[model samples]
Target: MGTDDGMQLAYYIVLLVVIGGAMLFELSGRGGQAIRQMMLWVVIFAGATLAATWWTDSGARQQVLEGGRIEIPVGRDGHFHLEAELNGVPIRFMVDTGASSIALGRDDARAIGIDLADLAYVGTAMTANGEVKTAPVTIDEIAIGDIVDRNVRAWVIGGEMDGSLLGMSYLRTFARVSFEGDLLVLER
Candidate 1:
């Protein structure tokens, strides 16, 4: 075997032993109490997981709204994510009604071929982390499945944000936007 490979193997073995020793020491000091608590937590988590699975699968889910509509299911964290195409590139956006316009993070804006240095940050937006600069721009197209929009107004936010936001600007294009149970249903 190569000398470097042997050295790396030894290093990994030592690291694992150290971590295992620390865990053993901590568990031994707790006199089996820590282990019992861990087992209890595991049981509780398993029960909750099974119950949530059953609850969601129980009902006769989502009959189509008359003609047709898009239904976004709420995540376990209670947020709705819509998979969309921005300027023909696929992306995911979090549905945020509180946001006035569609706000894109730096990376996403760049991915859609926006040159950040060329844009002017003249507008400001009040966010949870305080006000931040915004550069207004028109996106050529944004599409969710068959629903497509052209020349949509959006902002490239200056500071960090969780991700792109699908705000009222886009949501308003639909005839109706409603929430039923944990689903965000959009009627076009």
Candidate 2:
């Protein structure tokens, strides 16, 4: 192997062994009670650190009609409820600027009582894996927080996907978009 590459691999191996040994030693200390308590404290401290990091990193707060919208905490999956519904139906959509159009999952479309057959499959979207054909449809309404839009163009993503995505098409209507760390703040 090359000298630099070999040295790097050796360093990583040594680091892992040291860390593993330390962890094992720590686990075996004080008849396991002390070790357990220590582990608990470590977990608590880690969680607190993560929470603090998320709070500080998430961008500016959004003041919508009711009150405000805050960033969703890290590791806590699902969309944040800054507001209630999108297009007259309760929806929690992840904000995705990469999407060219606002995309809705099949379930969400059905919940909103939108007829999938009426929409035309007008475009092909390039995804991470490959290309997926998308159908285009117009929603009569979409409501979030206090903001509402009418006659919005949306793409229906087929298959077992659960949630809809709010993309730049609808987001552009907002005055400002800010993200701090994991938090995305949208202002209208």
Best by lDDT: 1
Q: List model 2 lDDT by residue over 1-188, tens digit each.
A: 54545885687567656755676677674667766765666676557657865775465333453443334332244334333365567776776778777888887887888787776677877766577668888888877655667888888886446467777897787676777665666655
- After superposition, the stretches of candidate 2 with alpha carbons farther than 4 Å from their true spots are 1-84
Please report how far candidate 1 places residue 159 from its true position, in Å. Answer: 0.8
Candidate 1 least-lDDT 10 residues: 59-68
Who wins the TM-score comparison? 1
Q: Give the C-alpha miss distance for residue 147 in model 2, angstroms.
A: 1.0
lDDT of 1: 0.80
The reply for model 1, stretches above 4 Å from the true place, is 1-68
Query: Taking the candidates one at a time, how many backbone clashes does each contain?
Result: 0, 6
What tens digits encode model 1's per-residue C-alpha lDDT throughout 34-57? 667556655665576578658854
For candidate 2, the per-residue lDDT at 120 reads 68
Score every model by TM-score. 0.66, 0.57
RMSD of each: 10.2, 10.1
